[model samples]
Target: MAEFESPIVMPKLITFLSSLLQRAAESNDINQSHQSQKISVFHGLSRPSISIQSYLERIFKYASCSPSCYIVAYVYLDRFTQRQPALPINSFNVHRLLITSVMIAAKFMDDLYYNNACYAQVGGISTTEMNFLEVDFLFGLGFNLNVTPTTFYKYCSYLERGMMMLQPQINMSESSLYMGISSKLHLSFNEDESSQSHHQQQQLAV
Candidate 1:
């Protein structure tokens, strides 16, 4: 079995995936003309009600696949983007793409996984559509699903570094907010704020 990622990393993955889906939604909203044409061709529907973060957390809780599967799915998403730059991730298609990539990753990386129907239910789609997505996605990827450990860890390393980079920005943002509040309350700024911010940053860094 593939190893589960550290608890710290899983949330980072979740955040990253959710952001990608949101960006796709934003891109689709901004480019209405392209979206209409693409939707007509693919029979796409309006965006789903569920948030990407909630959907991913549901899959993580129920799918029972290792964190490695999610990592691989990330790789697949990247590869799909590279291979089909014209067909970018968007609101109309992001949900299907997310489901398809994770299912493929589970099948490729895990010994046992649920079938199309099960995954479809989890993804809130019909089995027929799931099957269609699986086949189409496989062809689009040229069936290159294999991922060596070295490549996998490289991705993990990149994600870890990204998490590290994100922490300071979050801390600074929060610190700035705290400072603004403290100033309104007639509290002193520099020393106390700096120490409190540093402490909070340390907690998140871990």
Candidate 2:
């Protein structure tokens, strides 16, 4: 895996996967498709939705980091969809997919305190099952796990300070609003930069 010194530039991967997730969510209600196979690992189990939510909450609580880990996991899920068009669009395996993605993301973003067994315990899956799912997910994601965000909270803080300095007369409420808007705009700029970088890399590769 390439060590991403900069952040991961993968908006194409994110957009593609978001579409897949939407399609998967939709398919659960309507027609059944082969894309369902990719998600079948999530089926015939306990309360999958509740389980997924719990897993996410635990990740945030224990990871004690920015939502960057969550975002990276989501990007992994999305990237998987791009590679495997036959993935199932159902809730059956959504949690499994989410856990697998988070596991990979955690490993890449931070120290590996939690192993496959730990994830299995938290996600309510067997050790063997977790291992299998991890392998499957890794293969789908092309084993590329390095993902960081350029628009970190530090950047937001700097911009907020600049805003405050520039507009000293602004009241607290207005300053908060300005900070919020600036943060959002910064994130959008980061996304655009990542997209442009990816495009350039692709062009160079060709």
Worst 10-residue stretch by lDDT in candidate 1? 178-187
TM-score per candidate, chains pooled: 0.71, 0.55
Model 2 per-residue lDDT tens digits across residues 120-179: 877767999889888888887687554334433333233334344544464333224223
lDDT for 51 in candidate 2 is 40
Instruction: Estimate, for each residue in 70-154, the C-alpha lDDT of model 1 and write its tens digit.
Output: 7678777766655665666666777788888999888876677898999989988898988999998887778867654434544
Lowest summed lDDT window (length 10), candidate 2: 1-10
Candidate 2 stretches greater than 4 Å from native: 1-24, 27-29, 33-51, 58-66, 148-206
